[model samples]
Target: RLEPGGLTFTLADGAFGLGGARTPLDAPLRGRITVEGKDLEGLVAVAMGPEPRLGGGLKATFSLAGTAGRPVLTGEVALANVTVTETNPQCPEPRRRTLALPSVTLAAGWEDGRFTGRPLMASVAGGTVTATVIAQVDRRITVQLGDLAIRALPLERVLVDFLCHAQAVSGPLDLTGTAAFTAGDIPRTLSGAGQVKIGAGRIVGVQALRMLDAIASVAGAVGTLLGPGTPVSSSALAEFDSITGTYQARDGVLTSRDLVFNGRAVKATIAGQYNLASGALSFDVVAAVAGRNVRARVTGTAAAPSVSVVPASLLSPGDAGRIEKGLQDLLKRMR
Candidate 1:
């Protein structure tokens, strides 16, 4: 029993029964319904949920076409705000995470309880995020981010919101990654790989840089005493001109092998693994110097990482002589 132009149903603050459960509608659900027809249009002014795990404040206007059984949907959805606050036992303070996307435009097709979309765009954090999203109803979800351009986003804000830690670095971050996981398995089952490029950042709260300065001073002094053929100069390690790294995550552990930082004072190569589930960190950093390589081992949690300089002999079996020769060759140039 349907009208000629289809039947229109409107609900104001209503509840719909789905799979033996009543799902409450936030604002109004207005749709043009048709029997044995190929098109249906709907508008949900606001849709909100109660569960903390499930985000709230959703608004969308969508149109479904194709057929009653299989349909294609094109829509624009926006979330006013969604905040998740959790306290990690390992962290000293409560971690608060927020995602406030003003709009997410999607042109997706739905078939067999799944929605597939390509090149979706969202407005977030004063920047544009473009990604391909695929979600299986009650099964799994995958998102592939491409060419994310975030302008002047503070690293401290990100660390405090996501990692539940104090700010350790400051800079603008650009990255791309893909994430996939089961519907119900969140942070634990999340896995992905990405590359991040940090532009002109300063590292905070690292005492090893001071030690490096002292070592550089001593090297310069020795070079001065050895007459004019020595080419030793002090290094600036606090601020970096550029930093880049590639990271891979599997089963809640992220590992990076090509983390490099270039600065006026020092150039460092970092390799390490960070446990996403436990916030634990274990990294080895090596600074290239004239006489020998300075090695520092960083371990503990991201909130409070511990750093210690180890002996240069621990680097490799026969690297000392090679480093000496390299230094000698460099000093020969100064002569």
Candidate 2:
């Protein structure tokens, strides 16, 4: 069995341990770990077998320290075909999710009351998930993710579970992009914003095509979604290339660029901001989508993000009005 102490127990060479059930790493991990401290210290390692093609083994060193009432964790974790799961007591039912992990490799450093690291992803399937993250113990969490590849993913199913952690319905989502998350303390807020460039893949109710072909007529509708139908055509193969977007994080709020459905041609951009903090995190954004003049001006606060759609008539021929309104609303909402 292994326990939560300052030790690294492994079986590669006789044995290595860091306190949890006392079982070694190379052997099947059927052990238990327990730690009770505002401050923690420990080292962990997994034994390596003989074959190089098999795996490289794993090792990690970590510690939790605090000063002036602020706490921080420092560590490094490396692994192959390993699982990183949080052992919280709240998981009474076995249905709990471990945030499934395959290969684990990370080199991290923590200080100034935060937890930071450089983590990489070896594989993912649904595109509905993200893992590599840097957390600030006292404040926020920053994460960057690559694109995803899913098949026949139900948009509604993915949306519910993703937004509320509810039961996951059966469907696949193939997505690719970067994301950032911020966890709030009071009122228990959660902020997340990211952009994805989805390549060609089957979606439950989505049309498939090449991305670049869709962006040809974006200029036609650069003001409002209710404007004249976009005037563009594309033949995106849904294979090469991807959509692009921006994600921002401030305090515990998240803001995202519009979802450019295609490569700027047949879809309108959807930008929004949310605050998972104390008060409210509301914000707005504006951009042309699907060659339609669509945009919105929104504002709120880091604690309360908001959004407001800008009518097409108020937009300038060049769509500059929509852009200005978006920024203006963003600042005003913060008030």
Judged by lDDT, which candidate is best?
Answer: 1
Give lDDT per model, in order. 0.57, 0.40
TM-score of 2: 0.37
lDDT of 2 at 297: 55
Q: Per-residue lDDT for 163 in model 1?
A: 43
How far residue 284's Cα lies from its native spot in candidate 2, in Å, is 5.0
Supply candidate 2's per-residue lDDT for 92.
Answer: 40
Residues 135-154, candidate 2: write the lDDT tens digits: 55543443333332233334
Stretches > 4 Å off in candidate 2: 4-76, 80-98, 107-122, 126-243, 256-259, 263-266, 277-335
Give the per-residue lDDT digits (tens) of candidate 1, residues 202-311. 76533434444555664464345333444544335567888899988887788999999886666889999988667788988887654456677878876556667675
Per-candidate alpha-carbon RMSD to the true structure: 10.7, 15.4
lDDT of 2: 0.40
